[model samples]
Target: MLEYVKTILQKVSFNAYLFERELKKGMRYLMPTELEEFKDWCYATFGMSHQPILNRYFRPAY
Candidate 1:
């Protein structure tokens, strides 16, 4: 599951909206430990958790 998320994460940067959707799906499917590791990976990769960042960038602009 983590590997699947990693693979999607790699491609998601190409489209913020897609990233947002996929991320939500990931949250649904990932276990607690997997979510933690995913969070860690997000911090390591982008210097913060991916959730709020993706929301800010990908959500409908007001």
Candidate 2:
């Protein structure tokens, strides 16, 4: 899963919203700890703008 995320990041450099969409779409497979780790890595790698968008998908009902 981590490798998949890295592949997406490398391919897009965050140029495509598709990367975010894919992450959300692919999230069902992640464990809670993996999700939190991914969230942290994503924010650190992509910056805080990722927080709200990713969180929206992370907890869509909230």
Looking at model 2, residue 51 earns an lDDT score of 64
lDDT scores in order = 0.68, 0.66
lDDT of 2 at 23: 71
The deviation in Å at residue 21 for candidate 1 is 0.8
Query: Model 2 off-target regions past 4 Å?
Result: 48-52, 58-62
- How much is 33 displaced in model 2, in angstroms? 2.3
Tens digits of per-residue lDDT, candidate 1, 1-62, equal 88888788778856666767777787788887776677667657754535566545334438
Query: Model 2 over residues 1-62: C-alpha lDDT tens digits?
Result: 77686567657656548766677665766777787777667668766546666566656444
**In model 2, which range of ten residues has the least summed lDDT?**
53-62
TM-scores of all candidate predictions against the true structure: 0.67, 0.60
